[model samples]
Structure formats: C-alpha cells, structure tokens
Target: MMIEDVKLSIRHRAQRNYERQFDERNRVQTDGIVTLGRLTIESPNKNMGSEYVPSPGRLIEHAFAHLPPDLREYTFIDVGSGKGRILLHAALHDFKQIIGVEFAAELHAISKQNIAAFSAANKHHPPISGVLGDAIDFIIPDGKCVFFFYNPFGRPVMERVLENIAASYRQEPRKIYFMFLSLKHERGNDADANRELLERQAYLRPLKSWNANRGAWIKLQFGSHKLTMYETADAGNPIKRRQRGANGAAASHLE
Candidate 1:
C-alpha cells in the first residue's frame, strides 16, 4: 500500500477504537454521564442510563474562545452542571466567579468531590462553587453574566428558566450572554420549541449562529451532530414614561 494510504488506515483504526470505548462506557449506564470537559452527569432519564454524554469539553472551550477579554471580570454560570467541568474551566479562564447548579443529589456530590480534587491539584487556583439545587430556583448574581446550557431538559423547563432570567433582568438590567451548545437533534431541524421561548423573552436578541467545529468530532463518534452558539444582547434601561401633560384634561384640551 502507498505510504499515505497506510497512514489513513491507522487514523481510521484509532478513530474506531475511540468510538468503541465511548459506546461501551456510555451504553446501559443509568447515571447519564455525558463527558463535557472533566465533568459528567447521570442522565436524568433513567431508562437511558446515566450515559447521556454532555457536550465534549473541546466544544465548550471553543464557545468561550471568542468572548471579549472583558468577560474575564464577569461571572459564568452553568445550569445543569453535571460534574462542574464548565465551572472549573471558567475559573481557569479567570472569570471573576463561577457557579454551577445541578439538581441531582448524587451528581452534585460527585461534582463537589471533583472540584476538591481539582483544587488540591492546582493549589493556587481560585475556587469554583457547585450548588446542590435546581437551576430554576438558584439566585442569579447581579452583574455581567454568561449562562451556558447543553440541552439540559425538555422545552417546558427551558421556558420556565427563560422566564426566570427575564424577571431577574427586570430587577437589575445588565449584560447577559447565553451559550447554547448541541442544539440540533436527530430529527434534523432547529429546535424551535425552545427557540421560541427565548425569542419572546424581553431584552434578548439573537445575535447569530456560528457553526462550531466540535460537532465534527461528535459526529465522528455519534453519527452526525451540529452545534450552534446564540448570544443575548445586553439589557438596556427599562422602559419608562414621563408625564408630559395633565392626564385626562390634557387630551380634551388639545382636541
């Protein structure tokens, strides 16, 4: 065989091996452990087992790659943080504060353990907090923030989360950036159900969708997949009105 052909064969074999191990590790395990960064979660769906893989760590790293340098001063929050990988990485990036909210008790405990292990390994690093609570009820910090999601749940739950965010913005308007990954599904259409919920929320604008390279790697293992990033505009001053004239009398007098 030609030298190039031989090299290609080796690459193909290596790729296949990687997929086989991923499948074996993920297949039939009840705590959905999707590997994103160093974190993994037990898939909430018991039937699927906890093998539901979250976004790969590389993809998330890419998502934050374009963030302005100033975002280093903001807090980064990850909802449905399975094992706190995102939070930990955010800390390394120098985000002022990093918070991860997870609903599963077992996963939350695991996350804490992982954080401790990481902290001990990197003694000089800042701390990243992993909260044992539902993302819906967790208090959002007041400041420029980055919210990340990896299709943590169904559409209904996403709607409620968006509503909560809207309410938070209303209370204290600030800049918010949303990083959504793995948005497409096997059905091959934009996940409009959740997208619609985001569209209706005030003070949010769909900046644009950029094709993420991480999807290519995922596709190599899981057939085909795509990832998109959508950013939300900074919340501006709340709409208010000035009393320009006498209430009821002014209208009649002008007429």
Candidate 2:
C-alpha cells in the first residue's frame, strides 16, 4: 500500500479505538458518520449540507486548550452539532453554557438523548442542550460565545451564518471566538471552501497565539487536517483583502 494510505489506515484505526473507549466511558452513543442520504431533515439548503460526522474528542480538547484561561464568561456553541459529541466534550470545560445546533430531526433527537445521558453521568457540568432548526435561523445569543464548526455546510450557508453572527455583533458588540475544524472528507470540497470564506471575513481575524506559547502559531493536527481559530476583530479596524500585514505578507499564514 502507498505510504500515505498506510498512515491513513493507522489513523483510522486509532480513531476507532478512541471512539469506542469514548462511547463506553461516557455511556453515550455518539459515534459513526451518518451520510447525507440517511439524514431525515429537510431544508432549502439541504444540498449544501455535509454528512454528519462527530468531531474527534482529542481535536475538540486541543481546540479548547487554546481558549482564554477562564471560560466562565463564554458560551460554547457547536454549529451543525451531530449527535452532540462535541457538546458533551464542551461540558467538561468551564463555559457558562453549552449548545448544539442541529437541523436533522433524527440526529437532533439522538443528540438530545446523548445530552440527557451525559447530564446523568456528570451532575456538575455546564448547561448543555440541543437546538433543532436550520443553522441560519438559529439566533446568536447575546453574550460572549465561542462558536465551533466541523465542516458543517457549504460556503453559501456558512456565509449566511457568519452574517448572522456579524449582525448579532453589530447589535451587541461582545467577545466572539470562532473555532473551525476542517475534516478530510471522502467527497465534496466544503471544508476548503468554508475555510476560505472564513478567512475572507473583514470583521474576523485568525487567532495567532495558542496555549501558553505567546506569539506561537499552532494548528492542532487531526491526521493531515487542522483546526483553525478566528476571533472577532474591532469593527473599526476591519482587515482588508490582500492587505500587507505586520509580517509583510498579504495576510497571516493562518488567515
């Protein structure tokens, strides 16, 4: 077998092992990928949506590790949250609240059940719940929030979602962090397109520092893919496209 293929095989095996343990330890059913054809929800942008794949637990933790030291003031939201795996993982943190937005009725139901199971297991975790509706229709709560995405939908839908967030910011300016993990998919190019669209947002900028390493650039690995982080920029100092920055580049490498 080719070297990359072999490496991929090993990664898949490792992911399976981790997930099996995760499900057992948490006593929740949050594994497996449900293809688009299998999803039962209907929406105008249904064709723009990607299949349901739970974000890896390790990846989720790595992304959260880079957030501010104290998360008590922030709310954690997983857009297009499938089966609430990420939501369950978010509960381990100190966020004020945890929310999973899902459009699929079948997957949404499963996510609610998973939340119930997780709440039963851990009594002191943050308040976590599932919201069943189209992502664009889900109102952004007026508070400091860390919105997360795992290649949920196409660029068009993502643009709409970003606009919604931007609108919310306009009304009530607050701290907002966007955490996006680009998954390696077997079909379609939504991941790449979504990442590019995120970079193009003028009101958003890539988060440069991570963990305790000041000024250090980091992209936590998920096999060959990486999780990119962005935060709201001062609306007055919007980043223009292809504008040379401090490093004398059109944009930061992360952007």
Candidate 3:
C-alpha cells in the first residue's frame, strides 16, 4: 500500500479498536469503517465513487442544529450509506423513518445487523431499514424527507439521484432537504459541479450551505476532513437557485 493508504489504515484500526471497546458495553456494533474497492460490491457500473468513510458523530450533530424541528416528521434517507452510521444516528434522534441504501451486499448485511442490534439496545429508535441495491435505482418515496450524500458516488450517479429527488418532490410536493458533505471542497470540481447541478435543476432550489471554511480560513485544518451541508428552499416556491456568492472563500454556494 502507498504511504497515504498506510496512514489511513492506522487511523482506521484505531477507530475500530475504540469502537469495539465502547460498543461492547453499549451492545451495538456501529464503529467499523472501511473503504472498499469497486470489485467488493456487486454494483451495476463503475460510476459509484467515493470510499467508505463515516461522518463523525460531531458533524452529524452540527448538521442537525441547522435543520428544522419538522425533522421529526420526515423520513431520513442516506444515499451510499455504508455501515449506516448516519442512519443509526438519525434513529437515535427519532426520525419518522430511517433508511440506508447500500449496493454492497456485505456492507448491507453489516448495516442490517447493526440496525437490529442498535434497535435492541435502544428501544426508542424509530423504524429503520436497509435497501440493498444501486443508489441510482432508488426512487424517493412520497413524503417529507431529508437526503444525505457523503460524496457517495461520481457526478453522473449524483445527477441521477438528484433527478429522483426532484421527481419525488413534484409528485408529493413536500418539504425536503439535501445535506451533502463534500470532503476537500475546492474552487472548481465535482463538489462545485454538483452544487451547480443542484442550482440549475428547476425542481430543486438552493437554500444555504455550511462547510469547514464557512467563516475565516482556519490554519492547519486538513481539507479531506471538512464537511459541507446544503439547505434549500423547502417544499415549493418556484425558487431554483439562490444568490451567487462572489466574496465567499469556501465552495458552499448556499447563500
């Protein structure tokens, strides 16, 4: 393995060790995190981008803070939800329903097992399920919902997924939120490209965005570890894209 891969291995091992120790007492297995190769999953194509990386518990909390109280009434869906970390967290907060869509059979099985164990341990969690298939094929159910994407797939897959969300909105016409956490967001790339894509979509509207460099540029912060959350016009109001931020330092074009 390359040096970078080696460092990632060390950190991953440390995280697993800590989770194993803690999950033993908690009696829930949700600490394992690993990035797999394309061959690992029985996927339909190679457009599935990104590796298995869990959003830190803190980042999830920070995101929830920005969401509305109506969150309790919406179904939470995590696309490319490997290991179902976000689903597990959403369950604790009691979303009406929690779903994770993972194509990898092995990872899907692990998520199912984790959800069962977690529900057994915490009876207060809401209904949780796992969809074992390609994310591109997922049809957003009719209802108030929140979709989460951790840079799960490449641009092509993301565009398709967004189309599904927009279709669901037109069919149901309810409040929706797309919380996207793009790692290492730069000036121009898929991160910006996806944001631009969302902005251009007539059905979907851009509300607001928050990322690592939201304010003043912080020193020594690694870009890969950063998070960006996009909030858009809820429900329908004919708003497609928000204002184009010209003076901003980061890539989140939510304003």
Candidate 4:
C-alpha cells in the first residue's frame, strides 16, 4: 500500500477501537451542557450513538488553528448539528452568523431551547438559530460559509449533499470550508472522490490535517476521532455565453 493509505489504515483502526470503548460505557449524557465562551449549550452525548458524538473539542480547536485570525467575519454552519455544541462554539468566535441544521425534532427543540437560554444570559449578542430540517434539503446561505460535520450520516446522503453544494457553487461561487471529523478508513475512497470532484470545479483546497495520537489514555479521554480542514479557492466569475446566429455568426441583439 502507498504511504498515505498506510497512514489512513492506522488512523481508521485507532478510531474504531475508540468507538468500541465508548459503546461499552453504555451511559448517556444527553442533557449535559458545556459553556462555550459566554454561551451555554447542550453538549454531545454518547447515548446519541457513536454517529452523533460532537467533533472532539480538540479537533475544533486544531481546525481553526491556522485560520486568518479574523474568524469573526465568517459564518459557520453545521449540518446535522446536534445540541448546538458546534454552533455555540462557533458563535464564540467572530463569525458573523452561526446556524445549525438538525433533522431530529427532539434534538432541534433542545438546540433551540439552549440557544434561547444562552441568548437571554448574554443579552448583548445576537441569537443563533437552529432549523429543524434534513441536512440534505437545508438551504445553505450564499457567502463565505464554513460547513461542519461529524460523520452525520452515511455515504449516500453525504454524496447527495456534496452534489447539492457543487450546484450551489455553480450558481454563486463562494469560499467554502468543509470540516469533517471522525471519518473512517472504509469511507476513504468515497471521501477522496468527493474531494476530487470539488477540486475539479476549482472550488476547494485541502488546508490542514489534524491527527491525534490514539493511545489507550488518549482514546479514553476523547474517544477515537481526528479533524481536517479544507479551504476554498476564490469563486470563479460567472461566464456569459452567446448563441450563434442562423449562419453560425454571433446572434444579433433582439430589441
């Protein structure tokens, strides 16, 4: 196997082992809350299942490590955002807007309640909103957007979302940052294909990879997961095409 493939294999194995350990715990901490900057919100709980665990806090920190230092001007959007943990954290930054899209009705309610409560406490800040809708169907706002995911769904849904984003890029190109966490080895091929497709459109660029050591103690502390950031290239200018005339010449402008 190639060197990159070998590294991915090791990473996948470590992640699986860590997930298994979390499963064995059998404890659900859904109602637990964490403070992000001045906002209080519900945090990730293992009971939500392995798929719902929020991206590791360390992973989020590392992903933003190389940011331009003017994060406040950006907007962060988290799909399948559970309990608003990621959204709340993003709000603490300089992000102009923070939005979370959650399909589960119960989870969506929880997120709204948490955001409302946080807003009441921090009256000086603008309130963040959580929409109850399928991530696949949610409408992404037009602008420089930071999209976040923590293995929210399976490959098929992911593919559809990528296609949707590609379409959006075509319409109104914007810098898009995709942050994927706890990605597995088996999904590497599909992931790379999606990345290639985005690159082919001249829409994205791989920015950084945050790999965490997965020793026994480390796994016990944060579960099994790593994070990576993919940045966006400048949006291409819209191209305008003209139709050919009857004789293959440029079409005359109609009055």
In candidate 3, stretches whose alpha carbon ends up further than 4 angstroms from where it belongs are 1-26, 38-40, 185-189, 202-224, 238-255
- Give a tens-digit lDDT track for model 2, residues 51-114: 8878778766767888888999899999999899999888999999998899889999999998
TM of each candidate vs. truth: 0.66, 0.84, 0.74, 0.63
Per-residue accuracy of model 4 over 96-194 as CA lDDT, tens digit each: 788898766667777787676666555555347898766677786887778887766555666677778777877877677887765445353344444
lDDT, each prediction = 0.60, 0.80, 0.68, 0.60
lDDT of 1 by residue, 1-255 (tens): 996576556545655554444334423111235533333434343222222345554445656776766666678888877766666667667787788888676667777876776666566655589887666677878887889876665676677677787677778777787776553443432345556655555456554534434445445443323444545554575623222365543221110
Ranking by TM-score, best first? 2, 3, 1, 4
lDDT of each residue in 73-117, candidate 3, tens digit only: 888999988887778878767588988998877778888888888
**C-alpha lDDT (0 to 100) for residue 112 of candidate 2:** 91
Q: How far is candidate 3 from the true structure (C-alpha RMSD, Å)?
A: 6.7
Q: Which runs of model 4 end up more than 4 angstroms from their true locations?
A: 1-51, 183-202, 209-223, 237-255
Worst 10 residues of 1 by lDDT: 22-31
Model 4 residue 218 CA deviation (Å) reads 10
lDDT comparison, 2 vs 4, better candidate = 2
Every model: Cα RMSD to truth = 9.8, 5.2, 6.7, 10.8
Ranking by lDDT: 2, 3, 1, 4
